[model samples]
Every structure is written in structure tokens, then in C-alpha cells.
Target: MSVELEFEFEGILYSVVREFRGKAMSANAKFYKNNSLTTTGAKEVTSAIIKLTKMSKDAFMHTLFASQKELTSLSTLKNEDRKKMIRKLLGLEKIDFVEKELVEKSRELKREIEAFREVLLGEDEIKLKQEQIKESVTVKDAIAKEVLSKNEELEHIKLRERSIKKELELLSKTKEQKQKLFSELELAKNSKSSEILNQVKLSAELHQLEHKQEELKKLEPVKAEYTALQDQIKEQEKLKEFHLKKEGILKEQTLLREQYTKSKTDINTLERACEGYEEFVLNAKNLELNIAVLQESVNAKHTIENELKAEMAAEQKQIDITNAKIAKLHELGSEGACPTCTRPLIEEYDNVINSLVTVVNETHQKKINEHNKQLQNVVTQKAAFEAEAKVKEKEFSELINSIKVIESKLQDLKNAREYFVHVEQKGVKNKEELKELEQYGYDEKLHNGIKSSLTAIEAQYKHSLSLETELKRLVLVKADLENVTKKIEELKATCQNKETEFKLIIYDDVKHKHQLDEHESILKTVESKTALLNEIKV
Candidate 1:
């Protein structure tokens, strides 16, 4: 027959089972504390079970459970509060019947409250409906009084209609006489308007004839100014070839300026790329150091693990040796002979053998537990190191990739520099042309020339075209600069991200290695204690 008992403390559940053999019973139990025992503030439960068969039919197991705290110590609390606390201390299982009763009663009360609330709502609805009916009755009475007053007003309106019909007949006769008088008045007004219009046209013609001489005198100076502007236009035509040559030199200057700016940008980008590569290289070196440390820590864990394995094997060997010795003793004792000497086995030897075996088993069990704990720590350290190494290895690969991209861009920059040399040759020849123009003394003064005004305007148009072309080129160059700036920003962001990730990997790897060292030290202490505990003296 087997019986199981359960205990609960601070929300943690524990159970124990005992088996009875034949008609005899034994009470043997082992307890394991929670893994969070040291960290959490929960109390450990210590329980005792006693089974006694006062009667053969009534065998019962009596269990008494206690904790690190006592409910009786709550003497200063109020009576009800102390009782409530005592109930919580009893825990969920201890007060199962009472809690079920409370839950059922609470549900019944909740249903009763809902029924009462429903009755109150029904009464409120009835009151609201009665108010609405009374208001409808009052509205009906008001509408009835308004209808009666409107009937009296309809009688007065009929009497006024008869008097209006007589007045309308008198107005129709007077309206005919008034219309004839209006027709005569309109004829006189149209005749007077025609006479006034004829007078206004005659007066306007006389005024224009009087002003003709003054207008001719004002035009004489304006005609002379037009003649002078035409002369200035003709003189400016002599410089058309000079202006065209100057336009070419200005175009070359603009192109040279753009190329120079591009060269400066290329130099800056190369410098930054070099710096980024060097920084990443430095980071790679640091990663190597971290990897070395990690490897060393792994080696240390392996050494500890091997030593633990050896210790366990030695314990097993000791157990095997002890068992062999016991077997020999048992065989010799039964045969009534001693294997070491030609004498009978001593009684004292039996007692000594039992004590030795008990000590060996106890020590072996304790050492094995300590060894297992240390071995687990070493395994965990190795696992953590390997995981960090994986990420570090991934980042190192990314760093190499980044370096390759930068190198490719550097090659592109070198090609651009060769293109820049070709542009420089063109710029130098244009600069020489600009010097020649300077020596000949270019003049910008415009003189009036009516004979060549059209040609001068053509020269000005060509200059305007050159100005517009330069403006368009400037806008394109600005857009290109923005694009280059954007590319630089993107490259900067990528380099920064790679550097940060690589550094983080190295930093984390170092931290993991440091933790492994700490674990190794802890294992070393455990090993020392296990060795001391398992030591056997001859």
C-alpha cells in the first residue's frame, strides 16, 4: 500500500509518498529546496509525518507542518486581522472547504444584488413613461385653443376681401389715364437726349484741333533721343568678337572650378575612408585579443571538467575496491578463515568494515554532488563562450566585407582622378586664351550706332545665352554636390554602424570571457572542498 501527502508554503507546492511493504512500514523521506531559496524571501517548510496503526483497520498518517515564521507571533494585531492572517498562513489547501463556502455565498449575494438593481430600473422606466404621457396631454390642450382663435381670425379676413374688390375697380380706371401721360413725357425726354449728344461731338472735335500744334512740339525732342540711342547701338557692334571669345574663357573657368571642387571632395572622402578602415582594423585587433581571452577561458573550463571527470572515476574505483574488500571479508567469514593469515576472522573486523563502508558512501555522495555542481558551471561557461564566439566571428566577416567595399570605391576615385587630368589640360589652354584677351585690352563701353543696332542686339543675345547656359551648369553642379554629399553621409552611417557592431561584439566577448574566469575560480573553490571531503587516508 502507498499513500501520498502534499504540503504548500508561500505558493510553492511539495509532495511526499511513502510505500508500505508486506505488513511492515518505514518512514523514509528526502526534501529538495526550491532553486530560488537563497534569492527569494520565502520561508522553507519543515514537515514531519508520523504513521501509527493504533487499530489494524484505522491506519492514518498524521502530518505537522511548520515554517521559518510563526503565526502565534502576531499578538499585536487586531483580533479579526490576526485571524485573517492566520487563514493566509494556513495556505490554499488548508482552507479549501471554507474558501469554497465563501465563494458560493459571494456568488449568491451577487445574483441577489443584480435582481434588486433590475427591479429599481423597472420602476424608473415606469416613472419616465408616465411623465411622457402627461406632457402629451398638455400639448393636445394648447393645440385645441390655438385652432379656435384661428377660426375667429378667418371671419375678419373674409370681410376685408369684399372691400379690397371695390377699391381695385377704381384703381384700374385711374391707371389707364396715368399710362397715357407717361407716354407723352418719355417722347420729350428722348428728343432732348439726341440734341445734347450732337453738341458734345462738335465740342470734342474743336478741342482736338486746338491741341495738335502742342503735340507736334513735344515729339521733336523724343525723335532726337531715338536717333542718339541708335548711334550707341551701332558702336557696340565692334566688340562682338571679343565678347564671344570672353564667353569661352568664362565657360572654361566654370568647368575648372567644378573639377577643382570635385578633386577636393575626392581627397576628403579618401581621407575619411582611410580613417574608417584604420579604425575598423584596430577594432579587429581588439577582437583578436578578446577571442584569445575567450579561448584561454575555454581551455581553463576544459581542464576543470577533465579533473572533475577523473575525480568521479577515482571515486568509482574506490567504491569498486571497497566492494571487493567487503566481498572477500564476507566469503572468508562464512568459510571461517582469513585470506591474509591462516587464522579465523575477528568479530571486531565486522564492525570496522561496516563503519568504513558507511563513511566511504557518505563522503562519495557529498563529493559527487559538489563535482556535479562544478561540472555544470564549467559546461555553462563553455556554452556562453561558444555563443559569443559565433557572433564575434560573424562581425569579423562583416568587417572584411566593409573593407572590400571601401577598396573598390578607392579604385573608382583613382579612375576619376585620371579623368580630372584630361579636364585640367583643357582648362590650362583656356587660361592661356584668357591671358591673351587681357593683353589686347577688352573694352565694354557702348557707343550709339543706328546703322548696326540689329547686330549689336544679336551680340547681346548671344551673351545672354552664355549667361543662361552657365546658370544651368551651376544648378547641375549643385545637384551633383548634393548627391555626393548624400553618398558620403550614407558611407559614414554604414562605417559607423559596422564599427559600433564590431566593438559591441568585442566588448561582449570580453565580458563573457571575464565571467568564465570568475566561474572558473568558483569551480576551483568547489574542487578544493570536494577534494577535502573525498580524501581517503590509509
Candidate 2:
């Protein structure tokens, strides 16, 4: 089964969307980029990311392009009610639809920022960036899946086309040869003269003609067989068509089943993601509460600092040692560290040290003031870093999400690909089975075998024609021989008649001469008798 098609692909490429019984399943891309950079790795990863993001965003733009389903769930509340509920849940303003849009944009920005960070950040920073990367990976996976699906389909089509083309070429060659043979047969008949030969004087020629006539009689059954073969060939062709159609129907059914399975899987995955979204909401709420409590503690501590100054100075000194220990403890959270560093100082040496301690504390305070200003600058820098990190995280997350979508889509495509492969395999099996079906009613091979038998019959028929021609030639030759025999008989009769006439003429001449001789003898006797009688009378 083959189809001829002209494809125009300069502007648009075509591909098949496949299914294995119709279930979605992941497939890997044929080509992968490793240590490869495009757009100088400087043009900011190309607008392709933007295009894909927009495509995804447009799919749910009506829902404010929300990545999570939670926003849609919050949409039902009145503005003030929503504001109060939002503040209670996550310490935020109301769930304005506009806010959803802004949040989505922020997420996109976060993803972009995260990607930049991933590229720039040292190895130690990667642990902090992992969550962002996961998100980005998901998005990348989605696009990869879409591309892979199309490629697989294209490959299948190409393979199928090549196979069909080969079969078509073979058929064409066979058909052409058959036509050529028929043409040559026609040419042989036209060129060969059907004239009968003249009778000859040779007995060997007559014997040869007799043998040829016998050979002609032997060819009659062969001609009948040839005609039968031709009929069988026609019957076989019809069977082939029927089997092919059956194969096509089976292939189509295989594809349908795969599609159904993939849809079910997609629905299940969507449900699972919705549950995860609920968990995210809970975590966001807890973080908001913690931030609020921390702000209050900072305010209370600042207010009480002056009242406890002298006592606080001693306590502060103790607390500073503890603070240093705590920092060291954090640094050594997973390993061994200095334990004596946290112990408070005590003894008589304190008097000499107190003066030195005052000078040191005063200088330390001045240094602290300068450090606080520097810390403020660091804090500002950190905020900017955080902003950038958030954007990167958001962008990366989006990419990861997209990758997940791609992975899921890839799964669907894989399922589709598998389904098609199954369909194709089934089709091939059906064809094979059809061949195996010796049941004359369904088997194409059986029909072809019958056709071959018919062709043999046709060849026999042609032989019969040859025999008939020989028979005709023999009949013409026999008639010429009969005519020659009749002419020879006529010539023999004419020769016998001439011999009889010649005998008659000779006999007549002999009888006439004898009569004349007798007459002459009697006249001579009379004359002698008369002379004797006259002498006696005297």
C-alpha cells in the first residue's frame, strides 16, 4: 500500500502525532546539546525561551497565567474578604486578578534571574539554587518533549514511504516486463509468413510434415493450461487488495487505543500537581507568620537596650562570646569545632584588663559602628542579590515547570509513538497473518498461487494456439500433397491412351498391306491359269 505525495516544507514542516494504543509516554530527543552554547551565550539564551513561555502563558492567560491552581481557587472571595483571607493565609493583600498577573510575571522574572545565577554562582551557592533548577528543568523538558514527538513521527513516515516506494518500483518493473512479453508475441505473429510450401519430390520432407502435425496435436493441452493461468493471476490481484485493506483497519484501531490511555495518565498527573499546590499554600502561610513574629522581637529588644546598659554590658560581653560560639557551632553543625571558645573570663587579672577592655570596647564600638554601616551596605547588596536571585529562581522554576510539561507531553508523544509503532507492527503482523491464512477465502498468497497457476494455464493456452497453427499448417500442406497426387494420376492416364493409339495405327497398316499382297498374288495366278487354258484349247 503506497501513497504518492508532494510536500512543501520550506516554510512549514509536517509531522505525525503518534500514540501507542494511544497512551502518552515520554520519549528522548534525538539530538542533545552538551557543552554547547548558542547566541554567544551572551544574548541571554535567545528569545526562544520567551516565545515558549508566552505560548505556555497564553494557554492559561485567562486564569492570569497562574502556574498554580491555588489562585483560581481564591478568586471566588469578595475583594475585602479576599484581602483579609489572603493576609491571614500569607500576609498579603487581596487576591486581585491583576495580582495574579503580576505574580506570574514575577515568577517568569524569577526564573530568568535564577538561570543567570546558576551560570555565575560558585559551587557552594548551587545547593541554594537547586529548587530553582528543578523548576527550570521541568519547562525545558516540556519543549524537548514536543520537539521529540514530532521528530519520531517524521522518522516513521519516512520509513514507511521508503518501503512503499520500493514495492511500487518492483510492481512497475513486473508490469512492464509482462507488457513487453505480450508485445514480442504479437510481433512474432506479424513477421512470420503463414504461407504453405509447394510439394517437393522428397519422401523425407513428407515424413517431417507428418511429425510436425503430431507435435501440433501435443501442444493443444498446453494452450488450455495457459488460459487458466491468466484467470488465476487476476483472482490473486483482487485478494491482495482485500488483505491490504484489512491491515489498514487494524493499524487504525491500534492507534485509537493508545490515545485513550495517554489521556487517562495526563488527568492523573494534573490531579497530583493540584495536591502539591495545596502544600505550597500552607508553607507560604507559615513563612509569613514567622516573619511577623521576628519583626516584633527586634522592636522590643531595641527598646529595652538603654535600661539594662551596665548589667547588659556584662551580659552583652557574655552574650557576644556565646554568639561567637553559636556562629562557630553553626559552622561546625556537621563536624568538630572549638568548645572552650564559649567560656566566660574570670580572675584577678580582670582589673588590668578592665582598663584595656574599656579602651578596646570603645575602639570596638567605633569599629562596630563602621561595620554596621558596611553591614547596611552589604544588606542593601544582599537585597539586590535576593531580588536578582528571586527573578532567577522564578525563571528557572518556570523552565523546570515547562520541562515537566514537556516531559509529560513527551510521555504522551512516546505513548503516541509506541502506539503507532504498535499499529505498524500489528499491520505487519496482520499482513504476515494474512499470508499465513491458507484459508483460500482470505489468503492473498493463496490467491497469488492460484494466479500463478492461472498464468501457467494461459501459457498452456498459448501452446494450444501454437498447436492450432501447426494443425492449420499441416492441413494446408496435406491439401497441397493431395492435389499433386491427382495431377500425377492424370498424366499417367494420358500416356496410356497415347500408347493404345500407336498400336492401332501399326495394326491397320499391317492388315492393309497384307490385303494388297493377296490381291496381287490372285491376279498373278489367274494370268497363269488363263495362259494354260488357252494353250490346251488350241
Measured over all alpha carbons after superposition, the RMSD of each candidate to the real structure, in angstroms, is 45.3, 55.0
- Scored by lDDT, the top model is 1
lDDT of 2 by residue, 1-538 (tens): 1122222333533221212222454321111123232222212332333343454433334333433564665798889877765554552444465698999999999999988985686776887699789987897787667656656654555555555556555555555655555555444333322211234533345677677668766776665566566566667666666666666756765764675466556656655544444444455555445545544554444444433344445545754765565555556543443354433333323433344456456754555555556555545554554555555556555655655665565566556556656655665666576566445456656766776666555655665566565556566666667776565555455545544543443223454455456555655655565555444334
Give lDDT tens digits, candidate 1, residues 1-538: 6555666655766555454555555433333234322211112122222211122211221123434355456677898777766665555445677878999999999999988985565778899999999998888677766655654554454445444444444444445444544454454445445434544554554355335435444545544555565666544554556667878789879978898779868867775675576777778778877877887888888899999989988887777777777777876664455544646657656765686588578887668778889899999998898788778877877887887888787787777677678677878888888887664433554332343454545544454444444444444444554555555455455545544544443123454455456555655655554454344210
How many residue pairs of model 2 clash at the backbone?
Answer: 73
Model 2 global lDDT (CA atoms, 0 to 1): 0.53
lDDT at 255, model 2: 67
Residue 132 CA displacement from its true place in model 2, Å: 99
